[model samples]
Target: MKRSKRLILLPHCVLNQNAVVRDLAREPGSLSGLVRVCLEEGLGMIQLPCPEFTYLGAERPPMDREEYNAVAFRQHCRRLFAPVLEQVTEYLARGYRIVGLVGIAASPSCGLFTTHFRSGEGPGRGVFMEEVLAALEGEGLSLPSLDVPLGYGVDAEETTAFLARFRAFCGGHP
Candidate 1:
């Protein structure tokens, strides 16, 4: 067997909708289109933990970034990402090229490019992503990342557009 030496980091919810908040999942189990595209492209994937789900549990309500923006939660994000960071580091050390991150667009805990707040949506990294990206940079591993709506798996046209951009930006040349 051979290896591609390429992979992307994904939020746990991307692979397990059961980890998402009530009535917010786009698919029954996984984001089928996204997963299918990844599989077709032969890109490896590393599903990162869902900070909110792990901390607040499946029954927890969706929260705004401000509400989740506490020192305690920040610390928790770092704690949860520690092992993931180790895994990322190990992969890099073994010569694997990182394809980057794919996160929920408006999630308070995992949004990469856009986040949610009481007032409305805003541009920023989520608590978990803030920690994860910083940790990766501390190790000199700055990778590309993007965010999509919670309903990313809903429409094919949007999915195609998003994936094209994602691949062009985050794929190739690692």
Candidate 2:
């Protein structure tokens, strides 16, 4: 019997972590190289979250949430992730069984384990990744997500190892 293809979902911030997009109409990134690697490793599917979620409004407000309304803050997050959620749903519908998910390590919007906040600085925490994972879990998707926290530095070897690990998890030969 033929083995079912595996899918991987990753935030687009993985391509460009430091840049923010003020214009929503602009196309976000060309993660072609990364995608190529995935294909080369025998990954059958790849899903990318909407750029807006990772870029459009990534920075935290100048002041703490105490200066912002809870309703507005929640609204901001929902709006930013709206497009991403839509794309994620679409990917899931395409018979893509999520094998792994990758997220930035410390982005207020896309980090998986650490994100900056307004208060005296919260410990390693990324709201975006947490939210996305929760949603995926709600839908019964099982996938391992790795959060690489290097703010602006890309260690090619480490990243390659990370991807290799994901491939191994998916039954791909190391």
Candidate 3:
């Protein structure tokens, strides 16, 4: 069997902007630029589940970390992410290099480096991301994770900057 050199864990919303709640989607459908970059780099990609979507669905109102950081929500995230962790571990065991994750900034669930809470955005980990990181730590695994802004359409220059950062994070070139 062929093995990929790297695996990229992406937030599901990156692949399906339409799945996001109202006024949250950035691109019309998918973040094609990022997707194309990943394909060009020959990186294997895994679209991680949207915890909010699984728990509340597409029509649910947007929430901040304060709203989604309940114990029940954390437990739900762990349960929802169990299979993903298993798959990542299996890939590692099979000699595939699991590179890192690309998360959405300001997301209450999947944000990697920055999250939204209490009507403000700040430097923090999202609930789902926290759970995933904990799981990875428990298994003695570490991977680089980067965050992109939430609304890709809000600013062209910001989007370009994000893409540049993402490319840099993916090993300096795309």
Candidate 4:
């Protein structure tokens, strides 16, 4: 069977900034730069579920990891991740090479290396990220994951740095 060269898991906000809560989106009603990069490189991309949006809706108040770490929130994340895990597993079984899983840095529910906590930013994975990692572990699978913040605006320096990091995470160009 034919398989895609690479698979990239992206947070929902990266594709649909308008779905984000409050004024936190960097590119409202448009795709983030990261998504554009993936498309240009022809990588198979998957937009993961947004636990926050699913639970609280688009108009919900912005919150941090501390607030989203509750049992109910965690349960919601788990539920949201189940189908995602299944899809990843199917892709792997089909011999699709998953380059990496990309998340939103400093997000309360989707961050990988940085998370929003206690009204501030901190070093840690977000609630939904935790569940995703746990599901990957349960399946005995491991893949490189990185978090790229989306609210960094369109500054040239910031965009360059983010592209560099993303390229590095993908193991060089494309």
Candidate 5:
């Protein structure tokens, strides 16, 4: 059988709630609904490293984007994404289509937009995502991206909206 040759970059917590900060994990397991859609669409998932978990560990307190925006943390994001960048390039070389990135909407380190801050949620890419985008940009590559809000799956309505947006991102024939 022919391979699907399609992929999507994802933050680790999306696939592993175990990596989330204790109080913030809303799901009992992986986001099954999201995963189901991806599988149905034949989009392979690239689970990126959990920068907060790896840098601060699972037991650490919830932190915000400003707190994680230190020199060392930024450095770590760069180091951690190196191999992922290589993997993306390899897939590109092999003719795989990277559909886009799916990021947590309210994360401190992995949010693509609407990140947490000491004050409250605000708009911006999380620390780790900044590095990922920069690295990809340096290589002249960019992926269309979307965010699954923290409230995702809390209601059928929200989930429906995200799925619709996801389908549009996946594209279609002219």
Candidate 6:
């Protein structure tokens, strides 16, 4: 049976074992085997960049606080989101159908629902996900997002599950 080509945008962190924002570069092998696996399973994978923080934007971890700098937070968000926007645009232009975007949950910059940030008193959601979702909506791009928890933590089984869900969504083309 021939499977349709389905596009999935994966966060670089999940794909790269040695990736960190300190250098702003990733190892060449980060996406090596993963890409082949995606193709073998009928996915046209697009590896997207993820931003890392040196210190969680606070003296202490933002997960310990409740809010973050509204202005700086948005700027940081742009850093993470802009590249994804460009990648998605290019994929669609190349006739690739986007099935969904996969990101790490609990990430201040990429969390789908519960990212943490430093509030004046404690920690809270940095609102990065909300902004990304809104931006996509404004641009008329409705892409489903999968928030894979860290418990999966780069497990091969988790990756397989992710690909399966991605393929299912692409099959529906919504």
Best by lDDT: 5
- Candidate 2 has its poorest 10 consecutive residues by lDDT at 60-69
* lDDT of the candidates, in the order given: 0.83, 0.54, 0.86, 0.82, 0.87, 0.57
The C-alpha stretches of model 3 lying farther than 4 A from their native spots are 1-3, 172-174
Which residue pairs clash in candidate 6?
65-122, 65-123, 66-119, 66-122, 66-123, 66-124, 67-118, 67-119
RMSD per candidate (Å) reads 2.2, 5.8, 1.7, 2.0, 1.9, 6.3
Q: Is candidate 1 or candidate 4 better by lDDT?
A: 1
Q: Write the per-residue lDDT of candidate 1 for residues 10-96, one digit (tens) a residue.
A: 999889999999988888999876787677667888999888888899999878999999999999999988998888889889999
What digit string (tens of lDDT, one per residue) describes model 6 on residues 125-164? 3256566677678678987777655434256776666655
Candidate scoring better on lDDT of 1 and 3: 3
lDDT score, candidate 2: 0.54
Ranking by lDDT: 5, 3, 1, 4, 6, 2
After TM-score superposition, the amount by which residue 83's alpha carbon in candidate 1 deviates from its true location, in angstroms, is 0.9
Model 5 scores a C-alpha lDDT of 0.87
Error of 1 at 102 (Å): 1.3
For model 6, the local distance difference test gives 0.57
Model 5, residue 132: distance off in Å is 0.4
Higher-TM-score candidate among 1 and 4? 1
Summarize candidate 4's per-residue lDDT along 52-158 as a digit string, tens digits: 88898989999989999999998888898899898989988977878888888888888999999885998999999999999899999888988776545566687
Which candidate ranks first by TM-score, i.e. highest?
5
Once fitted onto the true fold, the runs of candidate 6 whose alpha carbons sit more than 4 angstroms away are 1-5, 20-37, 53-69, 117-126, 154-174
What C-alpha lDDT, on a 0 to 100 scale, does residue 43 get in candidate 2? Answer: 65
Candidate 4 lowest-lDDT run of ten: 147-156
- TM-score on alpha carbons, each prediction: 0.92, 0.59, 0.93, 0.91, 0.94, 0.61
